[model samples]
Structure formats: C-alpha cells, structure tokens
Target: MARVLYDLYGRDEQLRFSPYCWRVRMALAHKGLDVEVKPWRFQQKDAIAFANTDKVPVLCDGDQVVADSFAIMRYLDDAYPETPAVLGSGVSYQRALLFCHFVDRQISPALFRIVALDLLAAIHPDDRDYFRATREARFGCTLEEFHSPEQGQALLYKALAPVREVLRTSPFLDGETPSGADYLLFGSVMWANIVSRQAPVIEEPLVGDWFKRLCAAHNGLGDQALTVRDLGDEQSA
Candidate 1:
C-alpha cells in the first residue's frame, strides 16, 4: 500500500498554497492513481520521518519514498507511462517548463506575501501591531506598503500573463489536455482565491473559462477526508 501526505490545513505554522504539493495531487488524479492522503498538522515534521527531505506531500509507496513535488510528478509519469503524465516534449513541453521555472522564481515568492498576511492574522494578533510599527521603520512603510492592491494587480498580471495567453489560444496550457503547467497555475490561482480573495488573473474571460472547466471536472472529488489506513487497506499486496 502507498500513502501520500499533503498539508491540507495551512492553518498553523504551515506554508499555505503549496504549489509543489498541488502538482503531485493533480498528477495522481489525472493518472487515475489512487494514493492515500495523509493531512499533516502544522509543526508536525517529526511525524513525517519517512519524508527524508523533511517536507510535506511525500508519497510513500511500499518502501519507496517520493519527495519534492516535481520529482514525484515526473516519477509517476515514468512509472505510469501508459497514461502519460507529461505531454509532448516539443514546443509545448518547452513552454510548460519555461512557465514552471518562471512560476518558481517570480510568482511563488510574491504569492508568499498573501500567505504571510494570513498567518499574521491567525497566529500572532499581538505581533501584528508590533510588526506594523517595526516594519514601517525598517521598510519605509507598513506591510500594506509592499502589498498594496495596485501591487497585487501587477503581480497577478505578471504571474498569469503566460498562462492567460496559453488559455486564450488553447483549451489547456500545454495542449488540449491539462499538463504540469495547468496544475502549477491552478494551485497558484486557487491559493490566491482562498487566501487573498482575489484572482485578478482569472478575471480574464479565457482564463476564467478554463478555471470553470477544471472546477467542473473536480466537482466529483467532493470534500471527503482520506486517511492513511484507507489507502493502505486498499493497496494491493
């Protein structure tokens, strides 16, 4: 039996809106691979001893330990070549890889601000006041200075332009079917909507249409909570 652990609750000291974990989950779903999902509590790294890399979203299949979302996704693709996780390795693949790198360097960091803001509100209400005071002195303004609505809009544009353009031309980012790029962008956009309540990127008609389509596809998964035992029990010996 194999188990996949994801940080479902970004509630406590966890990194919310994890792009990496989202990629792995989507890959599993797309490939029709059943994985046991273990949702971890914040500050429970010791419990994930098999994670070796000390990270969330590790997939343990028998004795094999899979870490790093991209690596895991690639491994799945190779292991299940019949379904093929990645699309063609032509221009589409190149573009997808380019966007993946851009997302890691550009969008992911900016999006972290949204998570940090949410954490401040949840974990340290008192520190919020102190942070504002000190942050102003240090950064020339408060947290709002760097994370203004105007800046958020710009961040959304820069982060989503590649995806929006792709969606405008094609049904999916890579091709007719969703690929790694779709998962990456979906996770980022979903995070924005959940934490910041803003998805300026998806407001565009083309991108918005694509989002609706994916939502429709995933509507059947429901909000069911899965445990390790369930996955292990169902796994073949």
Candidate 2:
C-alpha cells in the first residue's frame, strides 16, 4: 500500500497550504517514497482521530500512524534506513532540529500575520468559525488587526535576517546540498507563497536566488504548487 499523507488544504483541496505539511511532503520526496496525499481540513478533526492528534501532516504507513510533522520525518528516517537520510549526520540533524524550531516559533508566527486574512478566506466554510476562534485567541486580536500586511511584512523581514546572512555565503543552510534545515525554512516561505496574494520578497539577492533554486527542486514541485490566487480564474491566467 502507498503511504498516506494527510495534508491540510483550503476550500480548494488542490491548494495545499500548510507549512508543516509541506515539510513532510518534501521530506518524503527526499527519501524517494511513494505517498498519496489526502486533503484534510480543520473541521475534519474526527477524520484523523485515529492518529490521536487534531493537527495535520499525519503519516499513515500501513499499521503505523504518525502525527506531527517532525515525528513523521523521524519515523520515515528510522523506518527506512536504506533510503537517503532525511536528517543527515548527527550534527546536521541537531542543526536541523534547531532550525525547525526556529521556523515554527519565530518565522511562522510573523508570516501568519501577513497571510491570516487570505488563509481565512481560503479555508473550507465549515472550518471558518473554528479557525477564527483559535487564531483570534492566539493573537489576542481580531483577524483583520492581526493580518496587518505592512507590520507583518516588516516582522517577516526582521525574522529572516539570520537566514539572509547565512545565504549570503552558503548555497544551502546545510552547506553544499539542501538539508532538513533548508526544507524547514523553505516550508515557512511556501506558506506565504501559497496563501497570500502578495508574496513576501526576500531583500537579499542570494536569498531570493536560493528560494528560486528550491522552487526548481524535485522537478519544479514547489513551483507547480497551487497558490491561493490560483484557485481563482484571474490568478490562474
């Protein structure tokens, strides 16, 4: 049986936008695993109850069910030792872990502000109330206030300063080749690209170049992903 990856999608199922899910998607591809992506929405918590987690990026490999993106990545690496390493060396794996945390805790929150309204508009109708309630509580403001494009863009640039400096010298965060750390950061940017009408621009020329390289990876898989506007006729054109 092909592995089942439960990925979060918007109203249009093809527009898969969850950053965490993207990380796992790239990781699976990195390992050359065949996966069937099942589009999941926020309101469909019961659909993934078997995994005992309300969140997405759930991996069901036969009898084994893994929730959480990081856990699923580790599961893939451990279960399929013959495949290419997802985390790479011990030192590299440690660095990847830190980068993942940084992306989640630092980068994602900033990016969320810019895309919050667009994300709200794109989610399934059934999930609207749930998403709004949860996100409003987390940010302690209305969605509109939270989704201040200008402020969000400034925060995003500030948060990405370290990444810009690193890319100034190295091709990838892990040195020569793209590593788990690179995927972690790329996934965050993919979040902005998929949900927002205005994609956040990386100020550093090298950083922009690195993003283009990532978009061209896996035979242009990233570039081919459906953006929010792609769901509409105008953006599709």
Candidate 3:
C-alpha cells in the first residue's frame, strides 16, 4: 500500500496551501519518500476524525496514523533510518526544533495576518462559515479587521528580521545545507506565496536569494503553487 498524506486544500482540490502540510511535503521530499497526497477540505472534519484531529497534514502509513507535522517528520526519520536524516545530531536537532517552533509561533502568525482574507477567499464555500467562526475566535477579531495588508506586511517584515540576519551569514538556516530548519521557514514563506500576491519583502539580498533557491527546490514545487492573484485572474476571464 502507498503512504497516504492528507493535505489541506483550497476552493480548488489542487490548491493545497497549508503551511504545516507544506512542511510535511518538503520533509517527505527531502527523505525521498513517495506519497499519494489526498486533498482535504476544512469542512471534511469527519473524514479525518479517525486520527482524533480535524486538522490535516495527517500521514497514514499502513496502520500507522500520525497527526501533527513535526510528529510525522520524526516518525518518517525514525521509521526509515536509511533515508536521508531530517534532524541531524543532538545540538543540530535542537536547533532545527527551535526553528520549527519559531516558524509556527512567531513567523506563521505574522504571515497569517497578511493572507487571512485571501485564504478565506480560496477555501471551499462549504467551509467558509466554520473557518470564519474558528479563526475569528482565535484572532479575537473579525477577519477584515485583523488582516490589514499594511499592518500585516510590517509585522511580517519585523518577524522575519532574525531569519534575514541568519540567512545573511549562511545559505540555509542549518548553515551550509538545507535541513529541517530550512524547510520549516520555507514552508511559512510558501504559505504566503500560495495564498497571496503580496509577499513580505526580505530586505537583505541574501535572504531574498535564499528564498529563490528554496522556491527552486523539490523540483520547483514552491514555484508551481498558484497564488491568490493567479486564481483571481483565472476567475476574471
């Protein structure tokens, strides 16, 4: 049986845009694992209820079911030890783990504000109500008020300062090579790239170059993702 990856999709089934899901996709690609990505919608909670979680990026490898992206990555690394390692040594692993946490806690929220409205527009119509209610509660504001483009852009730039500083000195967050840490941050940026036309500009030339390199990774997977503007163009004609 083929490994199954349940990925979050947008209005179109092919529009898989979840940052967490992208993290798992990149990690799987990094490990040279082949998977059948199943497009999952926000309203399809019962479909994934077997894993006891409504969210996706769930990996079902035969009888093994993993929910969280980080857990799934660790599972892949541990289960297939001969494959390329996701996490490196003791210290390196810790650093990678820190990047994962930083991307989720610090970077994702800032990027979320920028793409919140665009994301809402991209999701399946059936999921709109559920998405709004849950996200509004979490944000403590209506999506309109929360996703001010200017504010979001500013916050995103501020959040990315440390990342820019690091990339200025090294090609990847893991220094010389792309690692789990690089994928963690790349996934967050890919989230922006997929959902919105406006992306947070990295002031540093090195950071911008690094992002370009990442976009070209995994056989141009990031480059292939359609942005919200691209979707809009399709609808307009």
Candidate 4:
C-alpha cells in the first residue's frame, strides 16, 4: 500500500508552502510515516475531486483517503496505533483543539495579511487570479489594500502572546516534546516564514528559538522548507 499526500505548492512545485500541509507533514513525521508527497496547486481542483474537497493536505493512505489537515492527523493516530500520538487524549486533546482554534481564528489571519502579496508572487501563474479573487473576497479588501507589513507584523506579535508566554519557559507546547498544539502553531509560523521576504518574528529569543528547534525536528523535515528567510537578503539585493 502506497502512502501519499497531496500537498499545496507555489510556482516552484518544490515550494510546498501551505501551512495546513505543513501541519500534516509534521504530523506524519511524528508518526514515523513516510509518504510520497504530490504537489497540488490552487487551480487543480479536479485532481483532488475524489477526496470530495478542493483543499490540499489530502492524505491517501492505501484504501483510505483523508482530507483536511486536522482530520488527517487524527486518522494517523487511529490507524497507526504504535506510532507516537500527535494528539493526546482526555483534557490534553481538548486543550490542543482549543489552541488550534485560537491559531486559526487569530494568528492565521494577521499572518496572511503580512505574506498575502508574497504568496501572490509565488503561486503558479494559472492559480494567480483565483488565489487573489478568493482571498480578497474573504478578507473584504484587495490584497494590495490589506494590512501593511508593519501593521501585519505588529498584529502577528500581539496574536502570538499566548504561544510566546509558553515558549519562554517550555521547550515545546507539550512540555519537553511537541504535541498537536505545537504542530498547529508551527504551521501558522511557517506560513509567515516560507513566503514573507522578512519572516515575521515575535520575541526573537522566545518564539524565534522555538521556531528554529521546530524546523530541526522530525529529522529536519521542516528545515528543508523553502523559506524566503533563506533568500531574503538576495531578494532585497
């Protein structure tokens, strides 16, 4: 049985920069599962039609096809019981879900405003208009009219206060190691890191150091991500 993941990408197929997909990628790595990742673009709805969803981060594990990032992570723990659980049970699971919701409702929106234009510059040409049309409609403003970088950065930092407080003492959200909550927030941060010319930073030593450690986890799976942080100087030069 072949394990495969439909991951979202930018202009360069190698630039798999979808935050949700990154969540799944890290979850899979946590479960010690190796998958062949297929890059999907915004205009490629037909490609994932079988999953009954237009979104990427669809995992086809043998006969089971799981769509949605969070759903896929839950499925991994169920199917591969021997692997490390991405989400703990009881109160732990509920807490993780709560944190995920906070990131989705708060962190993601502000971060998007910061990198929306950078993402526009990076997506496949065929998906450009669709990306802009949908995002602009959702945000109620043209991408160019969206929050300025300075504002976006400030908003991101403010929204990240909870996570920053945690990292100030704990190495990971789940104490010594990572949990579902860590992956959720990491995905949001990766969104800013991968596309922004200058990746948004919140408390350089706190969040910054934690992010570096996350990128190095799962055998450097995320370390391989195509972050503009790596090319920011060249792009500006």
Candidate 5:
C-alpha cells in the first residue's frame, strides 16, 4: 500500500503548514508510519477531487481515501490496529474529540485573526486571491480590516485558560503522555507559530513548555517546521 498524505503548503512549497495537515502528520508519526508528504496549496482542489473533498490532509492509504483530520486519524487507528492507537477507544476518543472541537471553535479563530495578514503574505501566489476572497467573505471584511493582534491575543489566552491550568499540573493533555488532544492543540498553535511573526503560545510558560516538548516528539517533527520566527532567528544568526 502506498501511503501518501496531501499536506497544505504556503508560498514556499517546503513550508507545509496547515493545522489540519499537521494533525495528520503527527498522528502518522505517533503510529510509526512512513508516508510521502505531498505539498498541496489552497487553489489545488482538483488535485484532491479523487478523494471527493476539496481539502488538504487527504490521506491515500492504498485503497482507502480519507478526508478530514479527525476521520483520517480514525482511519489510521482502524487500518493499522497493530500500531499505537491514535484516538484510543470510545470514552478516550470522545475526550480527544472535544479538545479538537474546542481548538477549532475557540483557538483557531483567534489564531486566524492574529495571523490573517501574515497568512495572506505566506500563501502560494496562485492561492492569494482564493484565500483573500473566502476569508473576507467569511469575516465580512478585508484581511487588513480583520487583522486584530491585540484582540486575537486576548481571545487566544482566554480560550487557553483551562488548557494552561491543565499543563501546569500535567506534562501533556493525556497526563504524562501526549495523546490525540495534544496533537489537536499542537496543530492549532503550530498554525499560528508558522504563519505569524510571534507565537502567542510562548507567552504562557507552562503551555509553551508543553508545546516545546511535543515539538521535540516523533524525532523533533514539529520543531522542524519553517516558522516565521525561525526565519528571523536564522537571519539574526
């Protein structure tokens, strides 16, 4: 079976930085699976039409085609039962799913607003118009008008309050060990980290430390991402 994952990329094809795709990437790593990660862009819906979805993070595992991050993770667990469970069983999976929902509903919005313009700047040239149009239509304002660093930061911190409390006491979301919940949160924070000049998660020491640890997991997988902050650090170095 040819294991392939269509991951979203930015202006630089090497910069595969989609939150949903990151979730899948870490899930694959957690399961000790090897895959060919293909760089996909916002305007490349036709490329994934075979999967019946216009989104990246589409996993093609031989005969199986799975779309959506959560579904893909479920597929991973089911298809490779011998591997470590990505979503655990019933109750545990529900808990992880809740975290996924919280990140999508609360954290992702703030992160998006925080990096709205920066994200625009980083998108592939062919995707710029599509990104700007869809985003502006959703928010009813231009990216320039929607960009709210202060408010986004405030909202992000507020949404992360419970998460901070958890991290203060436990090393990971699943307590001692990172779980599906960890990947979901990490993916969202990574979206901001890679696209924005600043990583808001760094302001919260406990959560930031947890994030750092997870980045170093699966062989420094997340840490290897080409973050905006990394570029600045490189230039300064």
Candidate 6:
C-alpha cells in the first residue's frame, strides 16, 4: 500500500485545499490508488523527514517519494494514463495550463485575503486589536482597508467568472468529465468555503450551484479533510 504523509495539522492547515493538493487528491482517487493516509501534526516535521521534503501531502510508494502535489498528479497521470487525469490531448494540455495560469493570477489572491481575515478572527478577542495593528503595520494597510467585504467579493467573482463560463458550455470545465480544470476550480471554491463562510458576489448563480454540486459529489472526503488540527482526539491518541 502507498503511504501518503500529509500535514494534517498546521497553522495554515487549510492549505490542504490548496489547488495543488486538491488536484493530487483527485488524481489519486481517479486512478483508484489505494493509499494509507498518515496525518502529521504541524510540529512533527521530523516524522516526514524521510519523505525527502518538509511539505505535507508527500506520497511514498515502494521506493518512490513524490513531494510537490503538482508533480505527484503528473506522475499519476503518466504512470496510470488509462483513466487519464488530463483532458484532451497535446493541445488540451495547453488549454489546461491556461486555466491553471488564470487561477494562479486571479483566484489565489482573493483566497489569501479571505484566509488572512479568518486568521485574524481566530486571534484572541483581547489580542485582536493588537493583532490587527501589527498586521496593518506589516501589510501597510489598516484592518479596515484589508477587511473590505466588497473587495473580497469582487476578487472572488473575478476569479470565478472564467470557471462559470467554462461550466456553462460544458458539464465540466474541460468537457464531459472532470478534467484538470475541474480540479483547479474545485480546489479554489473549496478553499473559499473553508477559509471564509461568505459567498462571492456575482450575477450568475450557476457558479454557486455548481460549487454546491461538486461539494456534494465529494462530500465523503469532507470529514476526512485534515484542514484543521482537530482530527477528533488526535492529541489524545
């Protein structure tokens, strides 16, 4: 059995939903790769040292160690091309890159903002004021400036607009079935949901509905998701 060592716990544990990791998870599942998930605490860096990387979501199978999630997904696609993780052929690869590149340029920053606000909210109430002050100083922007709800929504909408367009034409982002683009959109939306409770403001409700559908389709992994440090008594065990 392959062993998947993940940063099950960390300050930014929510990074698990990162487009990078989400793609890997989808790829692995699509390939029917049986894996043993080893949840690692943020402090247990030593535990994953043998995996040859300090990052979580490291995959070890037999004698191979796959570090980065992107690498892992590509490896899975090439090694098990039967199921085909990517959509289309050579030209389709370029199209998939377009989606990934668009996501990197647009959706990711909004996610960062939402995440920062959520982290600030997690601070002690008494310490929140001080924390915001420090954050403002560090970012050269006041809490009020950083916490613009409208701005956050705008960013999210801008990012999601492209995905909506793709979904409008095709059931999935790329075509009939879930493609690399689908995984990217799923990861971004999942990150938005986990990191921030609010929905993005947009004219099209199709995006939100699609997100709901995708969440429902993948709900089994919801509980298994090691986003937060609470794995139901990880500390006790």
Backbone clashes under 3 angstroms, per model = 0, 0, 0, 0, 0, 0
Model 5 Cα shift for residue 68 (angstroms): 0.4
TM-score to true structure, per model: 0.72, 0.93, 0.92, 0.93, 0.94, 0.72
For candidate 2, write residues 217-237 as lDDT tens digits.
877879999887666643353
Residue pairs in collision within model 5: none
Q: What lDDT does each candidate get? A: 0.59, 0.83, 0.81, 0.83, 0.86, 0.60
Number of the predicted model whose TM-score against the real structure is largest: 5
lDDT head-to-head 4 vs 5, winner: 5
* Model 2 lDDT at residue 125: 66
Worst 10 residues of 1 by lDDT: 225-234
Which candidate leads in lDDT? 5
TM-score computed on alpha carbons, candidate 1: 0.72
Model 1: runs farther than 4 Å from truth? 12-16, 87-95, 113-116, 119-146, 197-201, 218-237
lDDT of 1 by residue, 1-237 (tens): 665555544433332445566667677788887887666643456877656765667787677777877667667766777885553356755666777788777776565554445433432233356546754675575565555555655675677777777677789876787777887676665555444433333456787777656544443331222212122211241
> What lDDT tens digits, residue by residue, belong to model 5 across residues 2-82?
999999987777777799999999999999999999988887789999999998889999889999999999889888889
Question: Mind giving the per-residue lDDT tens digits that candidate 3 earns over 1-237?
Answer: 679999988777778788889889888888888899998988788999999998998999989999988888888888888988777657877877887887888778877887788878877778889999999999899999888766766877788888788887888876787768888888777877777756543444676788888878878877887666566553562
**What ranking of all candidate models by lDDT puts the best one first?**
5, 4, 2, 3, 6, 1
* Worst lDDT 10-window in candidate 5: 228-237
- Candidate 6, 1-237: lDDT as tens digits: 555646342333342444456666666665667676664543456887887776667777766788876567666676667876653358776776777777777876666565667545433344467667766887698765676656766787777776778778877765776657777667666654554534342335787666555555444553355343332322342
Task: Point out the worst 10-residue segment of candidate 3 by lDDT.
Answer: 197-206
Candidate 4 clashes between residue pairs 3 or more apart in a chain or in different chains: none
Better of 3 and 6 by TM-score: 3
RMSD value for candidate 4: 2.4
Off by over 4 Å in 3: 199-204, 233-237
* Segments in model 2 whose C-alpha atoms lie over 4 Å from true places: 200-204, 233-237
Candidate 1 vs candidate 2: which has greater lDDT? 2
